[model samples]
Target: MKMIVGKGSCGIAAGANKVSDSAEQYIKDNNLDIDVSVTGCIGMCYLEPIVDFIRDDGTKTTYVLVNAENIKEIIDSELKGETLTKYEMPEVDKQRLEKQTRIALRNCGVINPEHIEEYIAKGGYKAIEKCVTEMTPEEVIEEIKVSGLAGRGGAGFPTWFKWNAARSAQGTKKYTICNADEGDPGAFMDRAVLEGDPHAVLEGMLIGAYAMGSDEGVIYVRAEYPLAIVRLNIAIKQAEEKGFLGDNIFGSNFSFRIRIKAGAGAFVCGEETALIASLEGERGMPRLKPPFPANKGYWQKPSNINNVETYANVAWIILNGGKAFSAMGTPNSKGTKVFALTGKIKKGGLVEIPMGATVKDVIFDIGGGIKEDRAFKAVQMGGPSGGCIPADLVDTLIDYKTLAATGAIMGSGGMVVMDETTCMVDMARFFLDFTCKESCGKCIHCRLGTKRMLEILTRITDGEGKDGDIELLESLALNIKSSALCGLGQTAPNPVLTTIRYFRNEYEDHIYKKKCTAHQCKNLVSYTIDADKCKGCTLCARNCPVGAISGTVKNPHVIDTDKCIKCGKCLSSCNFGAVIVD
Candidate 1:
């Protein structure tokens, strides 16, 4: 029997470690012969610490919201072949399962991440084995081409084209780089894959290295992801020990080695050129693109860079053949895309859905709808550099072409769902603020343009927006999108542009009426006392942090408008529902 505990970052955050320890203790205390192991996330983040119990008969039952307290009962019931219906998370319909295809995330939440043998046992390096033994370098590229696997790392560029370009390049020292430097604010899909299935990514890299005839592979990982780094280091050491890495891998004449290059948490480092510069021990910044990475990259040699998720998919495509993988998703965009569905959504975690799945299905069906049963407003896909998609367009198919056509890019798949309480103007301003700080300052449009746009958004959120502020924002967004050099700057205006396209009325209301429809912009709200319901409750007066409320023991409380800071402390303290924000 197999009893697995979720060990992803979200699971860890929800006390999965304690759950694991408790399960182990319970097993030992009960003298059970069950196998208790740790795995990655199962995407249901709302019911984290997800425990999966697989019986000897291969029937599996998943227990959601599993905590330390429930460990003993789960072990006794599930491990002992007893069913605990009370602990099981209700299974969704078959359509939801059919909509998802787990190619990149196949091994995730299935194997113990720290153990290399566990990964190997589950057909981990079969692709590299097939490639080294039977397939030639060009044949491997052709398989990827047939698979129609584009880069999952935001750009959606053809993966085989990148490999073929590097393979065709006239260079003695070509390079293969695994871009683990995922800098998107709400995106942890790459980090999860790296942490959970490092060997899968390494196997993909090995395949790429063999395909492109590259001898050296570098993993450009961000310093912030310590767990991923640790797991990656472990996987590298294990692979080298097993002769999967190092010279003449798998007895093949093709010699390859992989090294780790730590990034200093720079968002620009995710770009190919900037990642190359950082790997070269220089400051992370983007350069010109005409002489692209394929021709001249990474110490002026031919290089191919793909993000963690993209490389993770390579091994599967090689093993399963192209047609098997290509038949899953949309015609233009093939295969499953992993999204870190977060922000205001009920089930916020890693979700791997097929490319053609609509945004509505992702949000409502898989995500279990919005938190607190709030009305759906919009979803911000692609993180800070992405755009806001309105609730009306929820049925829009989520693919690279569809999102791009809607003036948004399928950025690293950070789907941040926003409810009715989220202010569109505030959302735009928040993302702009993030980008302004993360700007590499390589281009003036990204640096100054983002700052200016952030200022306008800030003014609008603060109720100081003028009639022309919206027009100014639109103009600046277009200029930035067109004039910027790198992707950071090029897509920096996405939030503003998409918000203006979808929630223009909210912007107009803020600019013209000086009111926040969502009541999110604190500056536009005023706290007042409803005299009829005050009941002379001095509790509000005493609890007022700013001393803005004053009243006698029996008389109705009144707020001194001039002195009130609109903090709403008295409102929360009042039991009679006297305080109101208008």
Candidate 2:
């Protein structure tokens, strides 16, 4: 029998390492023959620190939220051939896993990532071997073209087209790069893949290198993902020792070598040219289009770059045949896409679903809807650069064309669900603030225009907005979208434009009525005591941080708005429902 503990970043954060150590110590002390190992996250992060016990017959039982305290009891129960129902995975989480199709993340939580043999047992590097031995580079490219796999990074461009471009381009020193610099605020699809199954990405990159006639590969990952980098370094070394990488791979003429380049966490470097520029030891910034990366990339040679998720799909498409992958999703978007489901969500973690599933399907069925059973208001897709889709559009299909039609791009698949309590105006301001700060300051339109828009948004949220502030913001957004040199500036105005398009009423309330309907903007929120409900128990008065509440015991209390500071302490501290926010 074997016991596997989750050790991904999320699992580690939840104290899975302590659980693993305790279980190992127990096995050592008891002289048990059970083997203990670790695996990456299983996408059901809500029930993290998950422990799995595999019997000799291959039957596996999963236990959620396992800690050092109860791990011994669970192991003891398993040894006695008895099931502990309390520690077992919940039925709702099981349903969450059953509803979706997982392709890119197939082996993520199933195998031990640090072990090369485990990855190989699951057919790890076979796709690259097949590519080098049986088929030519053209055949491999044709297979990918048939699969209809687009770039999962954000652009949704055809992957085969980029490979073909680099293959046919005039350059002996070509390159195949993996864009692991995932910088979207709520996005971690790439990071999870890199941490959980680094081999899948490496094998995919190896296949890409073979098809593009490139012997050199580089994974440009952000420095923030230290765990992923460490695991990747381990995978690279293992692959080299096993001949899956390096010269004369599979005993063929095609040879490839891969190295890692740690990025400085610049959001703009997600763009290809900017990433290449950063790799060239220059300031991370985007360049003009005539000499696109396909023709002139990374040291001015012909190069092909695809993000981590895009590369993760390569081996699958190669093995299962492209037609199988194209069988899923809408006509435009093929196969499944991974999304980081976060914000006011009950099951906040990695979610991979087929392309055509509705937002309702993901949020309601898989995500278990909004937290605290609050009214779902909006979901921000594509991070700071992507726009918001209001509650009315919850049924919108998840696809390239469908989401784009809703003013939101399927940008790296970040679904930030918002509830009714979230102020749309302030939410827009928050995203605009992120983009404004992340701007590389290359273009006057992005640098200055976003600054101006942010100022107007700040004024609106602070209750100093005027009637024409919305119009001014719209005009500036259009200008920046048209004039900005890169995707960063062009899409920076998305959150603002989308908020105005869907929730213009919220903007008007903040600007014209001088009120924040959701009571989220502190400058506009006011606290008052309900005269009838106030028991004057002194709890509110004593808990008030600034001595804002006043009254004797057993009498009606009053809130001094001047001293309240809008902290809402009295509201929470009051046992009775006396405090009201307006």
Q: List lDDT for all candidates, in order.
A: 0.87, 0.93
> How many steric overlaps are in each model, in order?
1, 0
lDDT per residue, candidate 2, 289-386, as tens digits?
96889899989999999999999999999999999999999999999999999999999998999999999999999999999999999999999889
- Residue 518 displacement in candidate 1 (angstroms): 0.9
Over 81-178, each residue of candidate 1 has an lDDT whose tens digit, in order, gives 88898888675622444456777788888888888899999898888989999999999999999999999889999999999999999988999999
Model 1, residue 530: C-alpha shift (Å): 2.8
How far off is residue 340 in model 2, in Å? 0.9
lDDT value for model 2: 0.93
For model 1 the local lDDT of residue 557 reads 83
